[model samples]
Target chain A: MISLLQQEIESQPEVIARLLERETHHIQQIVAQLPPFDYALIAARGSSDHAATYAKYAWTTLAGYPVALAAPSLLTMYQARIRMAGALVIGISQSGQSPDIIAVLEEGKRQGRPTLAITNDGSSPLAAVADHVIELHAGPEKSVAATKTYTAQLAVMALFAAALSNDPRHMEETQQLPTALEATLRLSTPIMQAVERYRYMDRCITIGRGYNYATSFELALKLKELTYLMATAYSSADFRHGPIATIENGLPVFLVMPLGATFADMLTLAQDLRER
Target chain B: MISLLQQEIESQPEVIARLLERETHHIQQIVAQLPPFDYALIAARGSSDHAATYAKYAWTTLAGYPVALAAPSLLTMYQARIRMAGALVIGISQSGQSPDIIAVLEEGKRQGRPTLAITNDGSSPLAAVADHVIELHAGPEKSVAATKTYTAQLAVMALFAAALSNDPRHMEETQQLPTALEATLRLSTPIMQAVERYRYMDRCITIGRGYNYATSFELALKLKELTYLMATAYSSADFRHGPIATIENGLPVFLVMPLGATFADMLTLAQDLRER
Candidate 1:
């Protein structure tokens, strides 16, 4: 099954390539249409939401755009006072049909804010309402669980961030996504092997910081949805205050690392866990 | 802060009563309009997503609708073929702006499926595309860490299932939700006090069954998100497989019991853990 999925993923390089090109083009268009906005309100759910979160960080850090992640319920129920006049609402979803997302986007439209949809479904309702639509060509995935589509969404969002910021640096990094995804797939074997070892674990804790925070979140979800494992995800930094009390010998801990300044600190924490 | 939250929640009975009437009316109307379909698909993220997972069980058992929980990535990236042409797509969100939920709703619209959005923001993008919107009247929850909205969503979904299946059994039971919530809130002091007692532990495991399965899952999420704790949630039945190997002295195990059938089983498991 893993090999089949890997094969399926490999066959979609062109789709990934096309999706990258499309997002790149759409990013340029969004940059050209740069609405006078103070911040970007990004709305997304599940893995797509995680990708949007990554976009939030990238947009804030790279593009100097203030971004806030909104819960779909807040936009739908509260009619909260959003300073919408100068805000760009970016709705990210693969299907572009979730009722809450559509409602939020429609509300954004009603409020006269420009809305964009990053999706794979061109004819999706979100696309219909979006001022601009960036289509992802991930093709069909049969598993009830998500895999390739998540990587694809991340890739597109990375490109979107690059285009929005008009930062060549982000663009360069965005271009490396497909290759990164390919390399990441190699890690899947190790991850799967590791998961199998702890498949029957009463509980598992996944920890990461910064961009990888959502990575841990998504990983925990995958374990629950697929293997029915009991797992939780958390920011490594937050673990010290009170949560560390939950950790004990023999409990499985998975830490996601990105090469950065925080790596040293995370390593130290991991070492501490090992010694404990 | 927790006490303040409890006070606020206790004061909301009148508000919850009003909201319950409105939600029940909306749920009835939507369920009447639902086309014949094989199963239901719930798409959501974060706390709302956790509520939806609980709803999945309610829909399956109460409404007799085989329900599938969808991550937005599947709809957008993996292209998982949603099984029913007339399937009900229920999108749950507090803000109603999650991008992926919108994408899924967009896809459902393209496929001509009925879409329902349960959200707090009626004017948000998610409500805009929804055929029916059940607005949660949980007021403006200001905490970045969700508490009221989560419970409110669960309450609404429970009522929704009761309405959909025309089973007033749970509806009558649900009327006690606010009271139950208050009682749960009262237990908070004791629970936290208990937690404080074991705060020195490095990790803990929470287990439950049936609908409480998701309860365990959400508990883990809350523990991690709020306290940054390394907590894991597991099914009571699945606990003994291999995860029990890690169970030993000093490791805290929290078990949630359902109302009846599974309650005894959970008690047995707790006893076993105590003995271990």
Candidate 2:
């Protein structure tokens, strides 16, 4: 019998495939309806914040829109006034239950900024406040670890970037992502076996940057949440600076080696870590 | 013998005082000579990235200028074009040796944006490329863990915010921080006594947000750097969503409960952690 988490982790390919194919019109509409703003401000918490960070990289490099991750406590805790005019405010949450995120959306809407939400539940509070909502279309994820919904959120945001840029290549790659995910899932058996040695592994670090830096964060969170591993994440470049001092002999390190312009540098980091 | 790190931590007051008193002219010159931009883009790594996060909170709430933390690899790794015009780019570094940060400053300069660097080494690479440089007056910190420099960087950024907004209240607070830090350092005797139970502590989380979120990050980093503690940092609001699930009895939770708008929430979070 597989855990609910394992089941959901395996379901990502199907969920992402569905998200790209069925729910893109909503994102397209969001892209069309949003105000022409100089930048974007995103509000989220937990895994959703990691997803939002991914969008920060994508929106800058792909769409030429500078994206800033909002520290919602500025609104909720400090009670500061935010200038939302000529900016798009996006709230990313799976349940849409995070009050801080909802506050940002509501505030953005009140300030006449175009507000958008990417949430699993369109009926959730975030949706109620947002001017446009792009449902994650990831159905009822039951795992305490967000295996399916995390990937689905990534796909949805990737598609969102694609829509905003009118870039067909991104759309084509996103459409093919489900297949890539499926092929990748084939290693689960070996990965399960590999974890047997690390049952007592107490310390680790995850390194990534560029487009997949958010993946490093989410993966680190999942590892900590589900396995109780004392894992930390750093950008590959950052790892070189000083945190590398924390690495000891036999310390486990995880690298998200996504192929792209960052691949060569990540490979260097991987080699450096191996040398340690 | 007390390590250099401990000495540096104790020297924070003097370093910050020197910074505010002596570096005011350079900052004022920067304020007077810079092109007016819509917002700020900050680039940093490791502990400096944590400092950049503090600037994000301050620039948004205090100065009414939204700041985006630059993902440097977007240009260095992905070879992507960045929109830098009409923005102020700041690179924060202790040594000013991070190539990734230098890349951001160089690109911002090429794009004709005003670049300012805050660093301990006025002669380091970051200074050569910047349109303006504010030296951290924290002299000769030899420890692997930064102490005086981090606090100095924080003070400098606070002063920058004060100057940007021309807020006399913030300026007053900035001026008083050194004395406040000196007074706070007086508690080291009790603090050292308090850590007896946690001398063997292996796991912890540092919670803070708003003005002190960067303090949370810095504290967590220092714990990892010096003590090998598996310390993590989170905004109090984000902690409640999931990572709180990781808390067990006897886990060390350090809260940076500054007396500001975030005090009530930090108190609530401290209570919740105690209950757990």
Candidate 3:
């Protein structure tokens, strides 16, 4: 099943490219429509929501937009304390038919709020309600679990940032996304191999910081979802506060050392984990 | 610092109550508007994000609103490919001054969407841009670590749900929230005392399902945050897939059991964990 899903993902490269293009266009259109306000609200659920965290860092530093991420429950279920008179609500999902996502959009419309949706299914209820719709175009993800859609969402989001900021340099950088994804797919082999080493280990700690913090989270989620591994994600700083005490010689600690300003700190934290 | 923070939190019951009342009234007024929309978007950070997730369940089942949660990163950095129009964007925060949150709201506004801010600080940038404001009366949360504010946010959200649905049943149930919180606080005493028993244990797992699943995640977060304990949270069924292999005699496993549908299933799982 994993292999089949991987194939489905690989076959969707064109879909990814198209999704990125459409997302870029939508963002540019939204940017063209109104005056800049305070910040952007990136709303999603499950794996797509985790990808939004990654988007937060990319948009803030790369696109120079202040952003905040939230779950829909806050608006629909929570007392309508939080209000947006002229803010974009970007809803994301693979199926785009979840009742929660639809309800959120309905409430927004009644309030005369502008809403958007990114989805794999163009005909999904979410798409029907959205003022603008960016199709993921990843095709049918047969697995109950999501993999390609996740990466596609991330890619599309990155492209959207490039479009909104009108940064040609960033846009060019996004062109490399497919290649990077391919490279990442290759890298997963070694990671899977490494997993065999820890298959017998009692517990696993996955650690990263800053933007990579979400990567660590997604990695842990994937490990749990795919391999059913018992793993926890933590920020490098938080790991030292107490989780490290459990390091009894040879416990598995998978560290994601993504290149960024925080790389040195993360490396140091990884070293500390090893020493412990 | 931790003790001081704890003291401040304990002493703020009156403040929390007052803030709760104020915020509840504000939410009622907002939901009464029930503006036409397709979906709701909630943007929040940190503990407030957790409260948002808790609200998602209530929104879907109780108020019958389709909602989606988002991270600010998607809107600010990645410009996530989401359809944004006719949707309400909600920004939630205690301080409401996080640069990312501001950026996301600004982006949403530029898209001509309705924006809302739910905050402890009405003067914060988040509130400054919001079309509607639900000010959390949480008073001053002195702790860098949030406790009472999180609980208060949950309470406010619950009350908001009740107000929106015009269903006082949940509201009446929630009136017991303060007492339940007090009981939970009291229950923690024994859990804290018992922490010593498992502090030395090499591994710990926390499991729950449905709403309690979020509780399990929060519990793991607390354990990691407060004690630096390496803990993993999982849905009860998800645990069986692969994490169960790690279960053995002497490994510590914590179950956050709610008195509902999952009780029997969790009991069986607990027995399996014990046997393993």
TM of each candidate vs. truth = 0.54, 0.91, 0.64
Worst-scoring 10-residue span by lDDT in model 1 chain B: B75-84
Whole-model Cα lDDT of every candidate shown, in order = 0.69, 0.82, 0.68
TM-score of model 1, chain A?
0.90
lDDT score, residue B189, model 2? 100
For model 1, how does the per-residue alpha-carbon lDDT over A28-135 read when each residue is reduced to its tens digit? 777788676655667777777778666645554455444545454343333333334445778888788877777767877988888988787889999999888877
The per-residue C-alpha lDDT of model 3 at residue B254 equals 85
Candidate number with greatest lDDT = 2
Model 2 lDDT tens row, B35-120: 87867889887777878888888877887777788887776776666666557889998999888888889988998889999999
Across B134-229, the per-residue lDDT of candidate 3 in tens digits comes to 776777776556776776777777776677666888767766665666666677678778877675654478887655656776677676666656
Steric collisions counted per model:
68, 0, 89
Which regions of candidate 2 deviate over 4 angstroms? A1-3, B1-3, B25-29, B32-34, B123-125
The order of the candidates by TM-score, greatest first, is 2, 3, 1
Mind giving the per-residue lDDT tens digits that candidate 2 earns over A182-252?
A: 99999888988987988888768888888878888888888778776667788877667666776778888
Q: How many clashing residue pairs, candidate 2?
A: 0
Q: Residue A233 CA error for candidate 3 (Å)?
A: 1.5
Model 1: lDDT equals: 0.69
In the order shown, the candidates' Cα RMSDs to the true structure are 14.3, 2.6, 7.4
